[model samples]
Target: MRPSASVAALLLALIVPAAALAQAAPCDGGSVFEDRNGNGRRDAGEPGLQGQRVSDGERIVVSDAQGRYRLPLRDNRSQFLIKPAGYRLANRASGLPDYWLNVRLQAGPALKYGGMPVATSCRDYGLIPERRKAAGDLDVLVFADPQTKTATDVDYYRRDIVEPLLADRLAGRRVADLGLSLGDITHDDLSLYPKLNAVTASLEVPWLHAPGNHDLDFDATRDEDSLLSFRHVYGPDTFAWEEAQANFVVLDDVVYQPGSKADYIGGLRPDQFAFLESYLAGVSRQRLLVLAMHIPLFDAAPGRETFRRADRERLFGLLKDFPNLLVLSGHSHTQRHVFHDAASGWQGAKPLHEYNVGAACGAFWSGVKDAQGIPDTTMSDGTPNGYARLSVRADAGYGLRWFPARQSDSDKVANPYLRLYLPKVLRRGSYPSRGVFANVYMGREDSRVEYRLDDGDWKPMRRVEQPDPAVLAENARDDETERLRGYDRAATATPSAHLWNAPLPTDAAAGEHKVEVRVFDPWQGEQRMSASYRLLDTAQD
Candidate 1:
């Protein structure tokens, strides 16, 4: 039999020191209760919830039969709830889920961006019960590398990215169940966190954040204190959450090495590993396990490793038992899909899929201004600034779709998934050396792409390793002009992972020929676009 609430309170008071009774005590905790009255607080007759999971960054604890939990507090660490599947947390003034309590250091090192502000203890965590729905697909909104540097950038993010989604939700369109930002939430300016949070919270979904290299406190002497500001604003740097379709884990993979030649390296800490081992031991393998971070697990350069190899091996070993798994990362502004096999130390049943999502502020928000006074911000790989929608099925399989920040109204081919570049005029009988290029934004190497000329039989397009002509053209425009295009020039073109080419057919009798391109997207299925090019009669000239 469990002790009564009053008796439990008395026991806790007796066991805990008097000095630790205050809100900022070294050992602070309270009850987790069902908010039956719909108020944010626990009232009379409100029953305490047992078996709720809570964490103090490093260790996880469960509530007793009386719905009570206690944990030793660490300065600058957060106490956050691991939200269960069928309950919802009360919302704070910012409209974000009130799932965390920030604990600040009484006397800490001064940071360039102010460290965490003083906070009172969150004694009671009030969770409202939610009706259980029939198991179905789960949709999540994913944003990576917002990397906003200034207040102006935050405004652009609000107007360009947040508003449209908010409007869709307001208009009764299907919206995501939750949101996740893979990291680089700001560009070294931690002060913009609140503003960014406010804009994101307007959507009214709980948002989970992973800390990026840019989100660090450079002034901190050691790696442990690098995310002081981030922890204060967002909760734990590494944590987990549960949903009907999937189990999500967000990790702070950036390991700050103060005064080293490289400021930071992508890796996990010992404490994070301990937490993961503990949490994953009890996780159900029937659902998909998703690990979200700011750094890609694969190396960026051939011989040089971006993420620590040893840590990757250890992580892969831990995840080997989970059959359904996905890894989401940001940091490379360009987007691509990676499959981990034996060569990369993955010993899973199948190749592990890692989607390196494109940045929200494409190329550091650099490019010419649009009519709306926002930067073009196209990524170097020809993928536009955007976010991704991830859908997880009941079977634990997942699908993804990329959404560009804005679509070009003037595009001859209005397809959102593809952009094509073709010459305006070509000689009627010219050698078929000139080819039409296609940039499939969400394309993979295995993706099937083909083109047809004037309703002719389709010809397969060959995947190529070359810079995107569209972005190359933009680079040429910036280089040729003496005047500044915008606050900063567009990113220089890099060899795209998703580009394809097929020669245009010039032998056919032509005035204006319609070239249709179609790609079989892995998730979105078939997508098609059409463009026209005129044939020139040189004799007339």
Candidate 2:
């Protein structure tokens, strides 16, 4: 029907304001409904989960009896159901862990690299009923930086890493309880997200993923939009869940900014800090606090700040109230245990332990192929490409053990718990610049490492910071090999954090001698390992 201009002006005034109000409607919080049938979706009969806390990365609110809650959201954000002690969020058919919902009022500009495909409004979560177990005393497998770049690399991860973990049932522990991927789950190739999820699903466990620098959306113009794809795939980048008698806080510490190219720095967003402080305020100080992220909270090397000091200091301040704390990170492919205490600005009474675990994609899947066609991706720190098993006690005490990618019957018997390195050949009774080296993979500062010469008395091995000779040799092999050995050579060898050295015994005759090394790990079980060293009387030669 046609209308006069005066009548049309009145209609426009009425309709325009109504439409704008609808657009501004609140959706900051959503329902956490119960899916009794385990279908992973909210159906008609499903009831709402009440009294649970949900956060939108800034403020937290408790779900009412009807399971409805509201958050103060000013813009696009993610809201997650902090899996309470007695419940768990449902898993997706895509195999990716799903716990949160993205709340977007409207779509942003179309990105050159394609940001989130569509804006989501109602962020509802569905969960299957399950009784919560005390996660206080549990074993968890942590895989750092699988970083599968290509589809082929995904296959490599499936066959080489996932298959073994499944075959072993994560070293005979419960796989469904807890497992974590420190970060860098994919190598920039977001398409492989499904493949990685499928591989992780085989463990049949609840896995938490933290987004790394490579997981950011490169085309996003602002730092806040950098993780659109990641959130789209893995839910909230900053969320906390309590289980295993501890609080597991997963954060997206990678800050991406576009420059001549896309560059990233390690720091936490201001909002995330506020979210952390708010969430922790309600948490009991008795529980163990485990902070899991991609980039470490402190620098890996001296004078080189891998993380922002101001942000780290801020985080440290927030953690001051918690006495039981542990930090787990995986960015550097190498593995080492770092202690953050007063010297590092950590205000906790006890020094905080940060485990910079090794990568599952050792050396980025580099090195020569083996009989199974798997690349021998030994880490630059001389730690083999593998994973770690964290043993958490009900009281929050914990210990860690590193598992090499490959293990054989002989290896299981010889050095099942440690690694010993020694020179293959040495001149008898002559000046030896480099001596026997032992890489007690799990040794710490207070560890006792001693060596004995073929039934001789045990002698202590001095701890030294140096590049592992074996790792150096592995790199040299790729460099000197005439044939192409791998997609890329191992990263230039770096000084290992746990290396012990001792001078070869000159009393031994010019013959083949076995140098046996025994180590007493402060945390792991005792280990005994040996390697044969040849002494050639240079004068006779």
Candidate 3:
């Protein structure tokens, strides 16, 4: 990412404080205590609540002695903030927000937020990989960048998003799947993780964690410097597991790399790279690969509003091999779709799709207020605070749906296909000899779609009949055949009448007009999606 002049100047200022004064060093975590009633400082009875919790996004844990705690301790993105209870924070000197401990320890070590303290590896600490399988049919309550500066800010997450999804994430949604906070768990306070988790767990789903840059060791000098306390508590940062028709790989790529002044870098470590390669070797091509991380691959090239080209290119090079890759990332805080194509790869097929899940925090956790006076929580790119769902099939296909927090019914469809047609006019010369092409993958086969155009009334787009008689007879003879295997309802082996070649309304005029495609599933009850396009004049009209 290109460096911002303003940010560079600010760092320079931080490195060289305007007025230098020696400050008192508090306890293990720090001395940033809440006054509860906004008093001057901590006093008797208003003790800094002990045993508080903290998180980065992927991990969760309680505070330790001295009223401080580290979360998902081992994750590289472990930027911990104190989880303050019954209190809140104004902001930090970073101007980035509240105080967060950047674990990329290069700055040095700290009993507090000054820098990262080194320790023997987990092997040296007796920690090892615990062969664990995440719960089944798991409902994961994923919150991306819940960066809150004040308690009021936390309420927005608690009221608008979390409160509504509580029932679903706990039982109604996936039933057994757990919930996860993607990153930027809190604005800054390593202290905030606990208070946040306390409120989040009220939904009744166990929360996994991941750290974010905002949650990092701000005092770090080098990239390797990190919040060792996070590792000591949670497990390691990189890990894997299998579920339904997919295998999940959660990576910790937000490594604050070493730079001239002090900036964060994104990358995969040598050990993590090895770990991923090993995980990939055993997975079958038939299964879907879901790679979840905080940063997006090149920010999906979302105009110039994304990450640096070099970073994206580097990330793409690292993980473009798999046949079935579905990346779920959310760094830019916007919902974006990125596509990558490799001439030749192991699985051998079409290019890959990377989806950048907007944000649960939305726009660094700032925006307009809702009825509850909480900011609207809209993401920087105008997407609402929401989560995504992927329904996997017995076969190699999956259906994705995005749900906006403000809606009751699933009627909100965010990713409607953008329909593009070739040749404004269907001239006799260009018309396909086979008629026309119609792809019926309107999200799902069972979806009910009604269509209309400049003057024609709304009519349904039906899923017509399947195989030819001869082929059906042939398949009846053999229980297992390639043709039979590919002829399932979702997979059409042979084609017939085309949907794209609907007669261009013989009664229609030749002026510019509109063609509307309305799609919905009565079965889903509400979440119907629609798309519209312009129609050019018909040469022969």
lDDT preference between candidates 1 and 2, better one: 1
lDDT of 3 by residue, 324-442 (tens): 67776766665655555552221235667666665776654444344566554444333456766555543546555556664544434433222222234433333332211123222
* Superposed model 1: Cα runs more than 4 Å off: 1-29, 117-122, 132-134, 407-413, 539-541
Candidate achieving the largest TM-score: 1
Candidate 2: which stretches are off by over 4 Å? 1-24, 42-47, 72-74, 132-136, 168-173, 260-262, 408-416, 536-541
lDDT of 1 by residue, 1-541 (tens): 9999999979988987655654335455587999876568889998889998888767898999988888766566788888777777788776767788887647567888876776646577888887657287888999999999999999989987888787667988655788999999999999898899999988877788999999999999999789988887787899888887899999999999999999999999998998898889988899999999999999997878799999999999999978999999999999999999999999999999999999999889899998999999899999999899899998998999888885422334456698999888899988888889999999988989999999989989999979999899999999999999999999999999999999987787769999999999988889898898988767754
Best-first order by TM-score: 1, 2, 3
Best of the candidates, lDDT: 1
TM-score of each: 0.92, 0.89, 0.53
Could you list the CA RMSD of all candidates, in the order they appear? 4.9, 4.3, 18.0
**Residue 208, model 1, lDDT:** 88
Clashes of 1: 0
* Residue 469 local lDDT, model 1: 92
Cα lDDT for residue 171, model 3? 59
Show model 3 residue runs off by greater than 4 Å.
1-108, 111-141, 169-176, 227-234, 258-262, 284-286, 299-321, 343-348, 394-396, 410-541
Clashes of each: 0, 4, 56
Residue 478, model 3, lDDT: 40
Question: Global CA lDDT of candidate 3, please?
Answer: 0.48
